[model samples]
Target: MDKRDLVIRPIRAEDIGAVQDFLFTQLQELFAQDGQAAITDDVWGLGKTYLEPDNCNMWAVFTPEGTVVGTAAICAYNGRIELLKGRYHLPTTAEVGRCYIDAKLRRQGIGSKLVEAMTQFCKDHGYRTMYLHTHHFLPGGFNFWQKQGFAITIDQGGSLEIVHMEKIL
Candidate 1:
């Protein structure tokens, strides 16, 4: 498909239901393959909280036909990490989270575009830094973030397992 066929836009309130459905569907498929059930209602509730306007900023990637094929979010919050003491960091740094692209559209550059759009949005909103945590198990995620100029800022628990990366906007 031509790159011009894709469009990225800010997510609206009405898109929340469809986005939640998409995420639940994907999670269900993942658990079923592992002989487990879909996530519990409480977990879904927490996800809803994260997606709420008070907690996050969200955007959706759509096809020319208007199908919502991918989603990305940035959560603004405060943390008290000792490493940040007396340093120049935004009081409202944004953390990228809940990025998902339709399985059928994987490797079509949709994810990368969505992330770039989100980062640009953060910069426009006066945020100075962006961060995200990703599991090493996800193929290409680590490398993708690195290619986008994010560096590993923290490796929690000394496991070098779950990585937290950051980029200054």
Candidate 2:
């Protein structure tokens, strides 16, 4: 895909539906299993969790025709930081989440662009590090984040091996 054909920017209010549909269609199994209650808990709270905060945001990559092809987001890291048993300071960290690209658009640098935008946003807003977790289940998941400079902090080697990674800005 030609780089010039895509537009990457912070998501606007009007782009919410396209983002939801794009993500739902891409990861139907996860969302459908819960009857999409996850969307209501997360995507539906975008305004309070992302848009309205100075250190949080959600970005979307749009085609010229205005379809959402990719997305990335940063939100305040919540929960117990001590659970990871790492030297992480929660106040200086932002959680990187909701990163996905259209299946047809992979390997064309769209995901990297979205991550770049998120990292730059994190840097500008005074976040010292970005954190994320991924499992082996998603295609290209570990390699993608590793390429973006995130180092694996923990690899739970059990039935459900979730990998937690972090990148310092």
Per lDDT, the best of the predicted structures is 2
Q: How close is candidate 2 to the true structure, as a TM-score?
A: 0.87
Residue 58 in candidate 1, Cα distance off native in Å: 0.8
**lDDT tens readout by residue for model 1, 97-140:** 76777777777787888888887778777788887876564556
CA lDDT of every candidate: 0.69, 0.81
lDDT by residue (tens digit), candidate 2, 80-126: 55557556677788999888887788888989988988888888888
Highest TM-score among the candidates is held by which one? 2
Q: Poorest 10 consecutive residues of model 1 by lDDT? A: 38-47
Candidate 2 error regions (>4 Å): 29-40, 80-82
* Candidate 2 CA-lDDT value: 0.81
